[model samples]
Target chain A: MAKPTSRADSSTASAATEAVLGRGAALRGRVQGHGNVRVEGKLEGDVAIDGCFAVAQGGEVVADVQAGSLDVDGALEGDVTVSGAVVVRAGARVVGVVRGATVSVEEGASFSGRIEAEFDMPPELGGKAAR
Target chain B: MAATVIAQGITIEGDLTADDEVVVQGTLRGKLSSRDRVSIDAGALVEADVTGASLSIGGQVTGNVTASDRVDLVAGGKLVGDVKAARLTIADGASFKGNVDMDV
Candidate 1:
């Protein structure tokens, strides 16, 4: 009876369904998944996920990343394409084109790339274009 | 635990180097190097050279394995590669076809 209960608890723990790349870890290749991921290490591959992605303070990524949302607190040297939002926190360094629905770079974050946010064309811009 | 888990349905193709433990339940097709334990859960498919402190295989592995501590091939596991470890154990129902180097 106690073992069954423990198994149930473990199953519930697995329900969190998030992947973690811990500190001192290095992954070089393609990472494709359906759940969110938090990186606290080094990743040198393309990542395509259906959930949010986060690069922790001590983490570094050198590959293109695609996710539902992205939060960076480390160094990223590749393009990023997100369906939701992209946030670059303080002390982060990102050097690549960023495309998202909403993108935010914190004050202390260093970013050297183009940002393409999807938005409807304003009426003034449309009028100017027509003229 | 704060170990890394390669959840089911996910596929990783490349080299993975970790200082912490790793549990794989998905598909991994590359090199796995860890300073801690590495576990291949049942139903997982791994085709990579593995180097770790300890290794527990309950799935299918098709590469060389080098463990500093020990290697355990659990029941229903299938391994088709050489093994280099200090200690090794093979369960009754496991299938293994490889040379084992225990360093004598």
Candidate 2:
């Protein structure tokens, strides 16, 4: 596809603006951005963002997600990779592998997925010694 | 107020649907559908089939458009697609190249 014309000023402003998928909206493709994003509806494609990503209470996602951080309060059925943290809030239902620096699930959240937290292995486990 | 905004510099590929208003200021491809108004702001670029209750264009759109109420092509807007609406308006400075169906 041809690239969109870039206006320097607009690009800068866009980097700081948050993208919101409104309450009843839905997206079925790839979304790539440099700013934070919030979803309150449905998304059926992969999402890659340089900033935080959130799924609101009524939102639903069925694709892979990658971001700086992730906060979910809705339904997600895809793998997630976050550099910072992953928080599944109350009433959220997620079903996929989750990889992050920290992963937490609220009391009322429903999650059925593998959680991968990156951590340095201690030398006693032959981690550093093996290396 | 538009509940969803595809802010400047963002790029979306595929389909988008909403129940409320939507404003686009960036690049979007595939399809766009809204139950309410849809606005394509100046400098924005959209290449998709768009459906909404009302539509106002101030940017560039390349595809088919279906508006239940009205369609307005504002000044400086450029559209290259078919339009279907009950009412249509094209500003003096707007550019359009498509077929129009007012549902007569």
Candidate 3:
């Protein structure tokens, strides 16, 4: 088993909490941090999350996003960068660029952008490269 | 307002827009915009550009943050990016590696 990390390491390894952007809210600018964040409203700018990032089906965002993992169940117009994976659900609209180790575009999902990435298996997932 | 905790079962990958009083307990990967206090609970994972009136972090996040008010880092929080806010507080147990641009 892997060695356990200290409280300091744990805190550094993980930050923030589950955040949600209620419906009807509108925003414009830059946002960056670590944690799980959800948007069900509207946004126009740049966003980066360290953990997981999700866009609710009713949410709409126009900007660039980077994160460890991504799940889109809403509408997004911009670029995406992910260290882990990107999952685009049905009825989702995405227009921009994306770079990630793994990307999953669900059926009925529309996408218009450039994709650049190389999948790399995690340390915990050794000898598992199914490309 | 509530305790912070971003459970791994949840994942968000897109842009986010929020209003007053927010507590993250899931995963958010995108741009975040808020008008009031934005909290990042422990176990929460976020990667996005952030904007809020005030911010309280307790999870893992990357990117920049621009707060009209102040930005606070609670214990068990990890942030890696730049910040633009009037005030920024990093708790002793908080982990952060980034730049700070105050007076914005």
TM agreement with the true structure for every prediction: 0.86, 0.86, 0.51
Question: How do these models rank on TM-score, best leading?
Answer: 2, 1, 3
**DockQ preference between candidates 1 and 2, better one:** 2
RMSD of each: 6.0, 5.4, 10.7
Better of 2 and 3 by DockQ: 2
Off by over 4 Å in 3: A1-3, A6-16, A120-131, B1-104
Leading candidate by TM-score = 2
Task: Provide the lowest-lDDT 10-residue window in model 1 chain A.
Answer: A122-131
DockQ of all candidates, in order? Answer: 0.74, 0.79, 0.12
* Global lDDT scores for all candidate models: 0.89, 0.90, 0.75
A22 Cα displacement, candidate 2 (Å): 1.5
**Better structure of 2 and 3 per lDDT:** 2
TM-score of chain A of each: 0.83, 0.82, 0.78
Q: Looking at model 1, give its docking quality level.
A: medium
> Candidate 1, what DockQ?
0.74
lDDT by residue for model 2 (B1-104), tens: 46898877678999999999999988899999999999999999999999999999999999999999999999999999999999999999999999999989
- The better-scoring model by TM-score among 1 and 2 is 2
